[model samples]
Target: MKLLRISDLRAADIEAIWSLVGGGDASLRGTIAWSFEGNGIRTRTTFIQAFRDLGLAFTELPNLLKTDERACDLAGYLDPFYDAYVVREANHARLAEFAAASRRPVVNAMSSQGHPCEVLTDAFYLHTRVAPLERARVCLWGPTTNVLRSWHELAGVLGFPLRHACDRRFHETLDKVTFTEAAILPADVVITDGWPQGADDPRWSLTEEHLARMGSPMLLPTPPFSIGRELAFDPLRYRGFAGYAQKQLLLPVHKAILRHVLSR
Candidate 1:
């Protein structure tokens, strides 16, 4: 199966997957052609037979419906476009429509709306670490930009309750969900992710003080800074586990979704 990921992944990062596949089944192509005023196309490599990026070379579509149909046709005509069309964290409504129209499995790798697949990874990882979803109380503290989609998807799929805490800027976005900044954290689980580059606030970070109150077996998407294996006795903190692992592990699931969409 072929894969198209526009999430700025480096060629070397997927080396392990390439090695196992006996090498050179995939190729990488970069492009910003879908969006105007975007960066130009770049090149990379992968395990697939080939990969290509259109870059910001054209803007012929004036209507979303028409653009989507064109994209769908492109996928249909292109030999490597069938397996998956991963719209990586894009906010393009037309692209989503095109993906749906292309009859290709669409992967919501990351989106301004939601990160459902990441939520799947989190659920699987938590289930493997903990006993049950009900047994865990997750505290999600960060900007809604990244977690918004994932949160909803997680709740829908696992029924696991999540308590949210966001800054004043995003309070309106949290209107649908019950939340409080003063809510006691370090519950069964705590997540502090998706930092804004220029933002000054750091209230959402999992500080050392926060770790003190954490229960046994903490899970942090990013690891803490420590020189050596001092083994800080702050429960079994699952650190350094990135969201990309989910993308790799869930390839089969994505493939099925792609096949079903394309079969139409």
Candidate 2:
């Protein structure tokens, strides 16, 4: 019952999660233990609410688990006291290893490799509000990062058309991501992750003019999105900007995920 990545679940699994969205199974009383080192304000706060909604007791792991050995050992160390582990840390290898060592279920909230929950939430939004994911044309605009990787993994699993609009310098090694900004034109939905740190290129930025060019595709900028960087202008001015509206479903989505994980 470990959710390490998006490919771990399929379309049916997503549907199952959707079916269980609004109402949760509270009979399964499970306590959760969580630790965070990644930069995800939206992810952290939303899950805390999810914990409370499910009536699940949760505790924050202290910052003492620094070393890889101690971090992996934490699963067995806290196994008796905690029912489940939620970790949102930076190291992909360490996260995988810690999940391996844990006897209880491990939920990867975010990592250097992917953000499964966020991807799943976004996919759920598309399926429920926009279109079936199999037919949706997706375009992600930004540098290659964890969220993008998760989307890529999801695309491979769901058989959807995913076009990445990024600068050639950023994705020189990535074959699937296109070099030109024209990749956003034919998309049904356009999404974005954070711009590469210390790098600012307006060419890759999303502006009203860009959305207008795309003919008003659903625009979802993954959070911690910058104003002048990933977004060239204020996003609230654009009608297609559905970032906030889309993320509002995170509560139910996270509740479903927690229910599924803890029940198993």
Candidate 3:
């Protein structure tokens, strides 16, 4: 069982993952190889704590596994000893190749094309904290990046209303979902990915005013989000800014993911 993308997950798998988070999770314990980058401080810390709590050993691979041949060779070498593999890569195709080559369950920590784990964490948090996901109106304000793609896939699977607000220049890349400019939209949960370089529209920056106009929807910005880029005000002072505590849930969510995959 591998989860390389959000669309790869089924409804049953999604429920099972949530169940694991609720406790009484079985052993997902074993040696796990992590091929991740240096900038993944949040991910690394969460994974380390989750692994320790779940009785799994963590090993960081030195190589990025840039090419298929290298990824294949590494997978084969680790297949005998490792219980699972976690890969964080920018290239989706490369991560696919690696997952294809691995005999053990492979988990996508993240890729440029999608981020299943992070998005799942968000959905779970919303459901547990704000309201049922079905009742919430999600508004994603950013370019067509990994986070957006994952949210799109999950929203499709879950049958929720998701709106993408961005610069009109990038709308052509999106499909099927509701699209809008950087104007105020009726949103229960407002999210943002990274800022596009030189897309210096003040409207694109999610200001306190925008949140106020939207009736004080929760503001959950994706990690690596800059203060001045995607945000116009200090999010901490904002009423709906629950990101700091919300992000901490990544540990349990990821632990649930590991258990769900390995249990299969």
Candidate 4:
């Protein structure tokens, strides 16, 4: 059996996975569930819908803070029942440790280090809504947080042009990557996850003035966006904005990946 981490998947494999999911082959079914300990309505809703659509059994473990020993024990317990595990937690190190201990394939929902699944959905959105990914200019605004880290990882694999307009403090020390102040104006897609939890940085906010300058580019703010913090106006008013539809794109790819893992 092989571990199916997004970092290990090739570009072709990603395309194939999405294609498999979009085809909606009802024959594919399995026991899929998530073990998370935070508020992730969008991710949770999307996974449940994906599992239901694919005719797979879905369950969510109770939100419990497990000790390392208990976490490992639970993984062994779930090994006999589940085909895949989606984990969302604040600690990346612990999540990585859990994935290593788990017998089944582990899908990272989100962690302190990265959010691969969300980035995968972003890729799918660009593939369908915007230009070809190889030629697309993606501008990431805000901190070098988990989402940006995942994008950085993805850029290495996919060879896409990813530029960032971030605070000097949040800038990543990646080689050959461009960090620009003018990225918002020329970007094909402008993405932001907003500021860190309690920090208020007005300069990073996606104000109406900034949007006006972003000529016809797609706007994707990672879900549960704060109106005043991330965007000045309601994103629902923008023609290029992606809300639930962006989330919907994740379903097929997620289902496809799970199905592929099960077959292997």
Model 4 CA lDDT for position 59: 77
For residues 136-233, what per-residue lDDT tens digits would candidate 1 score against the true structure? 67666555655444554455334456676666666544322446565555566655554545543645554545545655325444223222221222
lDDT of 2: 0.79
- By summed lDDT, the worst window of 10 consecutive residues in model 3 runs over 169-178
Once model 4 is optimally superposed onto the true structure by TM-score, how far is the C-alpha of residue 87 displaced, in angstroms? Answer: 1.9
After superposing candidate 1, which stretches have Cα over 4 Å from the reference? 1-83, 172-177, 197-199, 214-217, 222-264
Tell me each candidate's TM-score. 0.55, 0.89, 0.92, 0.88
Candidate 1 contains a number of clashing pairs equal to 24
Better of 1 and 2 by lDDT: 2
lDDT per model vs. reference: 0.42, 0.79, 0.81, 0.73
The TM-score obtained by model 1 is 0.55
Instruction: Using TM-score, give the best candidate's number.
Output: 3
Question: Candidate 3 on 1-264: residue-level lDDT in tens?
Answer: 989888898877887898778584455558988888557888878877888888888888855576446777977877998898888887888888878988999888888788899999989998878888878888888677788889888877777767888878767544437778756777888898776556666667788878888889988888777888788877878877875777888999999998888878
lDDT of 2 by residue, 1-264 (tens): 788887787766666778887785464587898888855788888899988877889999854245755655667677899888888877777878777878888888888899999988998888878898877777888777889889887877766667787777656443333445455466788888886566677777878777777777878888877898898987787777785767878888888988887767
Local accuracy of candidate 4 as per-residue lDDT tens digits, 153-189: 7777677777888777666666435787545556788
Better of 1 and 2 by TM-score: 2
Q: After superposing candidate 3 on the true structure, give the runs of residues whose Cα lies further than 4 Å from its correct spot.
A: 24-27, 172-176, 196-200
Score residue 127 of candidate 2 by CA lDDT: 81
Q: Model 2 misses residue 166 by how many Å?
A: 1.0
